[model samples]
Target: MSPQVALRKAFSAFPTGVVAVCALVDERPVGMAVNSFTSISLDPPLVAVSVARTSSTWPTLATRGRLGMSVLGSEHEVLCRRLSARAVDRFEDAQWHATDDGAVLIDDAALWLECEVRSTFDGGDHEIVLMEVHEAETFPDVTPLVFHQSQFRELHADR
Candidate 1:
């Protein structure tokens, strides 16, 4: 197998939670579906998300650092899938609230984080974005949404 194949296989072994980072660009809300998001440092309230260099949304995201990160709930699979597609109106049926900067706070997310870009590192295939968490809040009821092996899956406790 080639490097790409091997990399994909290895990455697939690790499950991750899903999130959508949405921000305002030209007075419009743009959202990117991401799985490569994590908490990097707790002391400084920092988080990170990787974005592909070739992504069409990269240019717009690069122009702004203040963004909203919405952690999807287990019931949000349809919304997640809609945002991942290249189709029109990613937010057509979805309900969202506007932030001060005009980005969206997705309805019914498990958590919503408002952040500012702290720095970025050029990773080979993706740009690693380090964000400073300015503010954050969690929904009253939250069951996490997870992704594994290029498919949506959730965890359950075994007795």
Candidate 2:
């Protein structure tokens, strides 16, 4: 296998949750899929989501100032896939609400974060977006969508 294939295979074993990083540009929604999200700090309520520099959405979102991060629930695999596509009407047939900061908060998302873009840095093939949370909303019933081995999955705890 090629190095590219091997690299993908290696990382595929690491399960990750799907999230939509959305922002408003000229009153329009611009967002993308990210599995590279993590909590960096609790004291300041900070988070980080990395996006590919090549992603067209990055240019619009990074410059928009304010943004939202929505964690997709298990049944939202279709939404996750929709947002990841190259060119499509992402908001089509999707239900969402707007945040004060101008982020289009998707309905039924596991968690929604209204954040301000704090910083951006080059991360090889991606650009890391470090955001400061200004407000947050979370759901109580939805389970997060997980990605593993290049596929979507759900986990069951053995208790």
Candidate 3:
């Protein structure tokens, strides 16, 4: 197999939590589905998401002062696919709420975070967007969405 395909297959072995990174741009809510979300630090409360260099949505989000990140629930499969689809309104059939500061969070997410783009760094084909969390909330009952091998999954409780 080709090197790229090999690498992609290997990467898919790792399971990741799905998150919707969103913000209000020009009074319109915009967002993208990301599986590269991670917590960076705890002292100051930091988080990060890796976005591809060719992402048109990233440019608009970069210009925004604040953003919202929603850790999607297991039931958000359709929402995840829609957010990643090209030439479609990401929020068209999705339900969400926007904070007064313009941060948009998907409804029923496992967790919600209000953040600001703190810094960015070049990653080979993607840019690592580091954000500082201003506020956060967790839904104790919601199960987080998981992505693995290009498919969505759910975590089953261990017996």
RMSD (Å) per prediction:
1.6, 1.4, 0.8
Model 2 ranges off by over 4 Å? 157-159
Candidate 3 ranges with C-alpha deviation above 4 Å: none
Top model by TM-score, which number? Answer: 3
**Candidate 3 vs. true structure, TM-score:** 0.97
Give the C-alpha miss distance for residue 21 in model 3, angstroms. 0.6
Model 1, span 51-140: residue lDDT tens: 988788767866776788899888778888877888678777887876886556788888999888889999998999999998899985
Candidate 3's residue-wise lDDT over 93-143, tens digit each? Answer: 889989999999999999999999999998999999999999999998999
TM-score of each: 0.91, 0.93, 0.97
Whole-structure CA lDDT of model 1? 0.85
Candidate 2 C-alpha lDDT tens digits along 1-159:
999899989999999999888877777777788999998998899999888878888777777656888998888888888899987988777777777667877788889988888888889998898899988888968888999999999866688
Q: Count the clashes in each prediction.
A: 0, 0, 0
- Output the better candidate (2/3) by TM-score: 3
Error of 2 at 100 (Å): 2.3
Return the lDDT, model 3, position 7: 99
